[model samples]
Target: MVWRSILLLSMINLLLLFSSPPLRAEAASTSTVRPEFARKGALTCMKCHDDAAITQILLTPHAVKGDADTPFGQHDCESCHGASPEHVHSRPPEGALRDPPTVRFSGPHPSSLAERNAVCLGCHENGQAIHWTGSKHANNEVACTACHTVHIQKDPVLVRDRQATVCFSCHTEQRAQSFKPSHHPVREGKVICSDCHNPHGTGQDMMLVKDRINDTCYKCHAEKRGPFLFEHAPVREDCTLCHNPHGSTKPALLTLGVPWLCQECHDGGTHAGNPYNASKIFGNTLVAPAPQAMARGCLNCHLQIHGSNNPSAPFFTR
Candidate 1:
């Protein structure tokens, strides 16, 4: 009886194995396999992307092999592009596109904005970029690639001479203002957009480099930042109240020339209420031409117009 039972059990086991061949194959195929890195790193990517623009990244700071913080020091191209095993090894179907890298900075079918930024923020979340999270550029969906070109050896935004052109691409109004008659020395490369404004964002308004607009002006115009006995109310309040820092048609970047600019505030003062015009200067009139109507206007007497340390200079005049 025992021998008969053993033979029956062996026959049942063979039948089960034969009937479930598809299940056995499926189990083997579904087993989890880890994704792989390209064997030759950037060299493998260079096989297809061997253009000058792509290859020039080797000369950039990002390619420093000695710095473990850099891309080359870590996973080479995979450090920024991500481990793209399928992109490296998979074959595409007929007339279909091949797989793309995990993170793409640009190109038609590029990855999402958040995905691309996350990859950059992975390595650049500190320093000047720390305030980038809610910055105007980030809020407006401005990508880092919009201003920066990592593949290039020298990024235009980082070059003082070429920086304004990059900034002008978006700041069209400022660009027009920059070309005005009385303007900052931006075109001459003596001054740059970054000199006063921090594109990375700041706690100040208009992303000024300093806490206040006046403080930004004080960087170059230190003489104006005085603890004077008599201070001009407008000068203390805000520099933009009388001057346009970007550019202006008036001399000295003033919104309006001397007496006119001063009259905006001093309208009720003695002789200040009088309008000085061509009619007042040349036309036959009973009233004589006021001294304030001369070529230098209010500036003639108010030599210390900005402020005064003199004991008796009540009108900001020394």
Candidate 2:
């Protein structure tokens, strides 16, 4: 019996020696726990939230190891939210533990412009938003939350392809354009709203960071912005004069395209009925390929269709 007792005592000492260093490291890590902020509050957060879940929160991304570091993890409720002071008090105001005022993500709707936009501008000062103050949205009283939601993890804007929904909400005209038979593939989610429009502000018209609407389009179509051997004056002037910037009922966003389109100005009755009878765009009983070989209609040969340095007819033809 004496030998057994001695062995048990030795085992206990060995266990303590092994565990002490880890415990001490843990206590040191939490040493920064503010005395005023750390309370064995009466209402433990887990008391209602359930032990497994609160434990999960600490494990989640929103959980921060230290204050003033990277963003608190999503489920890391205590990081940006602060330590639950009254949590142990057991009688935290019914919603006392509710979202703090610093949490600008929520809404009963901010009473003022600064209050509403403040939530987002605090973080998103870079990127497309550097000059948002006098931009159209700011002037129109459109709040950041009016189009976006920071805390809303499940919304469409947070997703890549669906971000356009936020823009379409205000651009009802785009919505109307898509209803037509020959519009862009917006309804199918191919072209996003940001593709053409800069939601943020710029000194340019309609908040376009590009000086002109055609300049804005030239980015995607570099080939079209060139000073071609042959120029199409009307095309260079403003593509919108003959084209619909948004979707169109004419396949390629063209206002009218082909025979009827060219005839508007090219009406010498096809050079007074030349050999091929060019006046009848539908020659040989068919509109085989209207004017320009019919690939995307007029956009085919008039590749520099937007404008050309050639200066000939500048009628967007070869």
- Could you say which candidate leads in lDDT? 1
After superposition, the stretches of candidate 1 with alpha carbons farther than 4 Å from their true spots are 1-35, 93-96, 275-287
Worst 10 residues of 2 by lDDT: 36-45
Candidate 1: tens digits of C-alpha lDDT, residues 254-312: 99987888888887535665644333433655344666778788887788888999999
Q: Candidate 2's residue-wise lDDT over 20-72, tens digit each?
A: 55446556777654543323211134345443313333333223333333333
The clash count of every prediction, one per candidate, is 0, 18
Residue 315 miss distance in model 2 (angstroms): 6.1
Consecutive 10-residue window with the lowest summed lDDT within model 1: 10-19
lDDT of 2 at 288: 32
